[model samples]
Target: MKARTESDSVSAVAALADSSRRGVYEYILEADGPVSRDDVAGALGMVRGTAAFHLDRLAREELLTVSYRRLTGRSGPGSGRPTKLYAPAVREVSVSLPQRHYDLAAELLAAAVENSHRTGTPVEESLRRVAAEAGNSIGKDADSLEQALEKYGFKPETEEDGSIVLQNCPFHRLSQRHTATICGLNLDLLSAVTGKTGPEGCTAVLDPAPGRCCVRILPPDRD
Candidate 1:
């Protein structure tokens, strides 16, 4: 998961505000390591003051952490005072969406993928583990496989054909790098929790509206 947007953070869920804060969120998210405010501005092509302002808000909200450090002094000329760095405090953020009957499995799996890459792991390995972990909790006695999906936030309902439509995404608008990983995680979670192993190559689609993402589950069984 990536840092929450500004609107997201201020909204109900973990989200923040609009894209302005989201840009800073993304900057912290993409850095291979902790970064400075100046670097964030440079990375996002925004002014240093603007970046710092957002960074301060995120820190105030406990979204990110700011710390000052002292570095070795350079004998040359421009050896200034200690520098400051910013790092994402929380790894993931929550977004709200309407519940739909259709379950799109890919989006969830993509989340797992995003998380895996963020932590420097292969996508498949992370997904497999997530699948196994979630699947281990299910027993075959309750509602349909679709019903079981609800426990893991899948919210799936069978469509005209074998398609399972997506109704919600607990994680939305994360960084691009983390996007696919977390989507993958969601997929693995759905597959494991339900023991359906939804079709491969599932993709989560955001419709032409705000806070609307359509997830299409691939065939449960396919080559």
Candidate 2:
């Protein structure tokens, strides 16, 4: 499955904001299997057309998946048209203000722990390696450092000294509890991003400050 983007999450949330659409989605979620529009309409006390409208809307927003199957156990010619059915989508939808990425942090830390157990490398070293690998992957598709940082919710702001200060940390809560570890991972990740896709002679370094990300981007002479 493709990875869900922030816009996709926002669209899903908006789609469910309608009472009828939310009710239709909830009914499908509670079903044992995919349900037809008629089933939803009957269960929710809505008209068939209204239920169908909401179901299609939910499917369009990716909050529900659609399938077509004949309800009756009959063969091709004699059977009626395959009924459209709705089911809960496998993708999870989440939206956070200021745009946190705790899921990404959790994934990195879990991979680091597994790597440490398998190779006898220190957990911190494994974490840095994995985080750098992830950053490199992300950077390869990015056109510039600032674009990459902004895309990941770092909120980069350029300074007069030709440095970038990140105004927001994507892994804020995790860093608060495990400052050194999380900050180190953040620094390594941004460093890799800078190395792989540069704004020319820029470097990522740890420069922790209150109410901001721990990593900063600095020009060659300032680094």
Q: TM-score for candidate 1, please give it.
A: 0.35
Please name the candidate that would achieve the greatest lDDT relative to the true structure.
2
CA-lDDT, candidates in order: 0.58, 0.90
Model 2 C-alpha lDDT per residue in residues 1-223, reported as the tens digit of each score: 5756788889889999998888788878889999998999899999999988998988888888888898897868989999998889887888998899999999999999999999999998999999999999989978988788888999999899888999999999989999999999998899999998876678898889999999889987775
C-alpha displacement of 118 in model 2, angstroms? 1.3
**TM-score to true structure, per model:** 0.35, 0.96
Candidate 1 regions off by >4 Å? 1-15, 71-79, 95-223
State the lDDT of candidate 1 residue by residue for 1-223, as single tens digits: 4433435433523335567788778778788888888888888888999888888878777778788754555544567776787888854444444333122335436655886989877777867675556554442433555655564454566667666665555445441247555555555445554454333443323222244333455454432
Task: Supply candidate 1's per-residue lDDT for 2.
Answer: 47
